[model samples]
Target: MNTAAWSRIARRHPSAFLLAVQLLSLMVYPLFDGLPGGRLVFGAFGATALVLAVWVVNRSPAVNWVAWSLAIPALLCAVSAAVFRNQALLVTASLLEALLYFYAAGALILYMMNDNRVTADELFAAGATFTLLAWGFAYLFVVCQVWYPGSFSGAVEPERARTWLELLFLSFTNLAAVGLGDVLPLRSEARVLVMLEQFAGVGYVAVVVSRLIGLTILRQGRDS
Candidate 1:
């Protein structure tokens, strides 16, 4: 496609782009995660996702500058953490990333709830918001694990700190209200966070998703 075509698509479907990159990262992550020379690659992927998230936020009702402000420091911290392998930097990055994701999720939610008309982008935004919430909680889980070592226990390595993917799996399970898998939160703080995520997951479906579905049904009925 031409540049204009790509730009048009981006303008029309910013949320779709954000959702695509995030889902694509899930597949690409395992390939680079925990392997030699993985940090640099992972950092690149993270930076790309952050940029896309900022773009999506710009399309929302939220202040675009705020997203940029958060993303810049978060990107810097993420790169520094990945390159230096510094635990302190990693913690800071995770905290910043969690905040950024939460902010973006909120923006997308506002965009979706701003109007009754359920456009294609709004539908995509719904899915994107779900992923953003999952990522935010996963990053929070990372910080929680650092603050309280052995916060999570897994079937394979009961004593070791859970991997990023493992934490993400736990986050997804909690957010989707599915039963927890191998990774279990053992600490009070971790359990509390998990409970909050469970509520968020249920509430998203009950509120945002149901609203979208109802609106779509209403629109279809009017057309028919």
Candidate 2:
């Protein structure tokens, strides 16, 4: 094909990829509870990210090669998460996905850093919207279980109820990688999942935050 034809084929709209990401995320929200369904739910999350990566690799210009290289490992991690029935595997897969998303998010942010097509405020708003949407779905998953009864005890053998407050506290702890022992995961799967989340959480902070900090310091030095 001609060079012009190739260029046209490679430049897909970013919205197409983002929509795939959102659909995959929608599939993950319901599957957090300790059950067979939860496994499938999280599987979808990784799958969606994988699909987005593929689309990005095919379309994103000269950068497509680098994106493909990083995306291959990410998609493999997603496949591993999908195939493994172990709870730990699922959690690990998610942690990997979290890390992959961290990289993806950074790439997007850097792409927009100087572009006038979207304002920094607009980008921040978009990020917050996705975060809130994810949080809402996760909450609804728990509430629906409570509104109806669960296959397993919501809390534990002796405890009668599962509080959103407690779940939130643990979720943040997992995100922050500061595991306090009080809210331990009872199921083996949950434990595996938590460990993956913890690892991803720490690694993400280490990689992404440090990069952003360096960017800021460089910006300051340049300004001065």
Which candidate comes out best when scored by TM-score?
Answer: 1
- CA RMSD, predictions in order: 0.9, 10.5
Report the number of backbone clashes for model 2.
1
Off by over 4 Å in 1: none
| Poorest lDDT segment (10 consecutive residues) of candidate 1 | 36-45
Off by over 4 Å in 2: 1-13, 16-20, 31-38, 53-63, 86-95, 119-125, 128-224
In model 1, pairs of residues that clash are none
Against the hidden reference, what TM-scores do the models get? 0.97, 0.42
TM-score of 2: 0.42
lDDT, candidate 1, 71-98, per-residue tens: 9999999999988899999999899889
Which one is best on lDDT? Answer: 1
Cα TM-score of candidate 1? 0.97
lDDT of 1: 0.92
